[model samples]
Target: MAEQTTEQTCPQCGLDMPVDAGYPVWCTGCEWNVAPELFVYGLGGTAARRRELAGRHSEGTFEELAREGTRGRRARLTASYVLSYALALMVHGLSFALLGAGVGLLVAGGGNPVAWAVGVPLVLLFLVLLPRFPRLGSRVPRLERADAPRLFGLIDEVAGEVGTRGVDVIVVDGRVNAGVHTYGLRQRVLHLGLGLWAVLTPQQKVALLGHELGHFAGGDTRHGSVVGSALYTLRLWVEVLRPERWNGRVARVLVALPLTPPHHAAQSVLSLLEKVSLRGFPRREYLADDLAAEVASTEGARDLMETLLHAARIDDELHRLAADLSGPHETLWAQLADRVAAVPPRERERLRRVSALEWHQQDATHPPTHLRVELLDRRGPSTPKVVLDRRTEKAVERELRPSARRLARTIAQER
Candidate 1:
């Protein structure tokens, strides 16, 4: 062998440099920038550049991307766990305090053991049952790959394209809706309602999957999942502590009685709390949609919006049919006639038209379809790079106010 020489060029300014000149063979000819680590990692050679281009050209390694995604997911879940514990502690303390105050009153009233026993159980109930109620121990269901291989492959391909992980895909057999969720450690799950699958064409399905991938890429699934879990726990606590199903007279009597007045008062306070918390759930849904849009393409967002609209129409029709079935009937035949009449001919025709449409539309817990479409159609990057405009910020702030208030109230009530 005479002499093996290597040729290298600066990727930035296209100036030639000799290889084996230590690291970062910066071209003296131009102000080109290259990280020395790239060379250290054996990614600086011509072959490496060609490989890089090839990797970029190809679909890329799904397994490598998924592994990275799993690492990110683990960090998010850890944070959620910490936050959940903190919130749980606050709720537990408040419940305990209320129970104590209620018991103290009963003690002053000739040391009533019956009242003590009743109060203790209520405390126990709040402690044991309240934290997990409403959204208790809900896990993202696992998707079987064998049943929907094509769908799973599509999901994996899309996820890889988006540089995210394919969440565990599940099929819910009904007319519900598709959703992506990140819940607990090592769990990112996507559920596609059978109704949605049945209705959507392959392209529409791809669009829906893209929209969901957007959710994962935008970190919406993790954020929303944690917030949703917290809300679930809080709602359950409120339900347990708050008075419900009690007659007005009974409630008044309970309120007036000094021995258990603290418990009644706590219950009253929680009723107000429940009313406030209910409003936040709707707002979070909107934020999640916005986040989803940021991750997916504008077309994906539009498709999602359309899907929601179609679902709403279908749901409305279903409700109408149900209403017709429940009407006052002269006989079985009359009931059948009523059911037939309940479905509006125009609505049925619309459903047929919607069904024939190229895209699949499914119901969502998001804003109205018109509003969503308007948002999606606006000319800009899917994810804004600049500071949000004042008007948009104000709208988001207004939407979040209720949740902020609930958080503040929870803090205050704990004190």
Candidate 2:
């Protein structure tokens, strides 16, 4: 037989080369090697040329890469919460002080030094204490003995795989989703919803756990929490100082006669701050999903996405059945059973046979089913795509507008 030469091309560049030299055929033209998997998947032959062109054109900057690493909805929401609260407090304090002074002048005609003393001190105390008080000195409570060992071990194992410290784990007895939170330095805590534990498969569980870890790794937990706390307090002060017009006649009387407008405003501001903090809660979720992909495989991230979708479907059915029951206090378990029965017989059988171990909680602030599926579908080896459906985007906007308004009001009042 005559001797023959084998030729290969680089995936990054389009230069032809010898195949026998190595498994990863390098393109002499672009100086990039074709991934072995791409070759195995039958992109190795004539398709290799196409891949080379794709790789050459698909370049990204360091800044873009960094942004991808840290991108998370939760972190942004937390930041918004913090800012809104801080501004709310400032506005509420100023409003209260000015209003109190005005009222004191009108009532006592410059003879009420005591009113100024008390009012000023009260305002100062609120400014100094409100933002720091609620969130400070609070910790994620410990998990029970029965739950602690396995949960902690799993967290440690996942953290180890990602080259990071394991987060402190807690099991909250609620029908909600999981979250990772940081209070102070090295005080990371992972809270798992008992409902999630009931439904997720082992693989799905790990994926969800990994997702929470991603939040910590992305640096959203600790500093964001601190900022959120501060903002919450500030909002509280604003609410106390500037009660809303719709606060009803009784509330108006209370504010005008005893509490004063500033006090009412401060209370309103605080309530707004609390609500805004919740806004960050949702954005962190998207970031955690991205982190999950980075730490583990995209497959792992997909598992989490699927599990959440399933949980949501189950919860929605249960919620609808509960709404129909016409009782003040219907048992959730019974409602769930009724919901299960309402499904088609074939589907009901499948659900009935599902293990108790496969149920997740219902109250988590997870994005809807379609959105999660879309996100997972968009992920690949090279890069992950962010798919913000119109509904989620709209919800985000709706939540943010009120928060921004509160922050702006606080800023104006303070000035």
Candidate 3:
């Protein structure tokens, strides 16, 4: 049963967006909306009380706000990295120490010959079982300015607007998302998912890139090195204790009994540290969105936000199409764009309502589309001067068409 809750209002536009136990509320005036889950922050309060608690902060330099908000998460991440490295060192130290002890016992013929016998196998086991960090994969392909000057020029302009060094590499892999990655100290790579680009207008893509480039200006990618490596290290140790990877089922169970403790312990600590270290991600997303709004047009922001609301449904269609290999072949990429371009107004409205139900936290990086839309809407409409005529958009598509075809073919061949 649902409990009584206070009426809520848009903290940005100051319009009633009542808090119900189930339904999301949207402000009519500003058209700002949020999912019901956000109501938890305002539960059991009068309209006045809810308004007081859900107070809106000033929107200004996103970079400053992101750094200020994520300071705690950043500290915890640094600590987590230290823990990860210490654990790695501990594994190495234990392995070497066991090897030395076994050798010493054998060389001297210590008091317990039986103990030496046990040590010999134990040292060998540790040596064999010591986990190694997997080598980084070079699966994703990179894009350079020489390959696509127009796309790179647009990215560089966005980066310049956000006041940062342009990304060193642009990696385009066919997917429906985009982000920046840091590699080897100072090199940064920008990943632009062509699937998403295929579905968005050139103007809206400008907004998307602005959001990603904003991460650079906000210094979020810089923090990824330690936090990301810690997660990888945690995975490596957890993989080390996999009993299933052992020789015989009987021996596996016998060996796993003792190994289980460290396995669970590592898993538990890693789980908590991950959430704590990334708790500030939603705020960082907002900062990125703000940069997008500032750099791109308000209309562009609206397009990007609305597209996010429709993304799941569109992606599902893409999946189905990719599965039906017998379907038309020549214009498959164009079909994805056609799907987006063909959405009816009434259907779009229905999708917004349906997608609004999914506003709960899945991760720290992104908030639900409704909240992001509301946030963007509150920024007030600004005339974005990005004019990507059909000719230019068609040209961009032509450049990307080959990659899209390859992705579709790959997906079709997957069993």
Write one digit per residue (lDDT tens) for candidate 1, span 191-305.
Answer: 6553344344334455566656655664542234444454555555444444443547767467434325544554554444344333232233333344444445455555555
Q: Report the alpha-carbon TM-score of model 1 versus the true structure.
A: 0.42
| Candidate 2, 256-336: lDDT as tens digits | 445465566556665665555444443454556656665555775765564554465565654454445443232443345
Each model's lDDT comes to 0.44, 0.47, 0.62
- For all predicted structures, in order, the TM-scores are 0.42, 0.46, 0.64
Task: Estimate candidate 3's RMSD in Å.
Answer: 9.2
RMSD vs true structure, all candidates? 23.4, 18.8, 9.2
Candidate structures ordered by lDDT, highest first: 3, 2, 1
lDDT of 2 at 5: 41
Q: How many clashing pairs in candidate 1?
A: 2
lDDT tens digits, residue span 275-335, model 3: 6555555566776777777678767866887887766666776777777656655355677
- Superior candidate under TM-score, 1 versus 3: 3
lDDT winner between 2 and 3, please give it: 3
Using TM-score as the measure, the top candidate is 3
Task: Evaluate model 2: give its lDDT.
Answer: 0.47
Steric overlap count per candidate: 2, 43, 0
Q: Which residue pairs show backbone clashes in model 3?
A: none
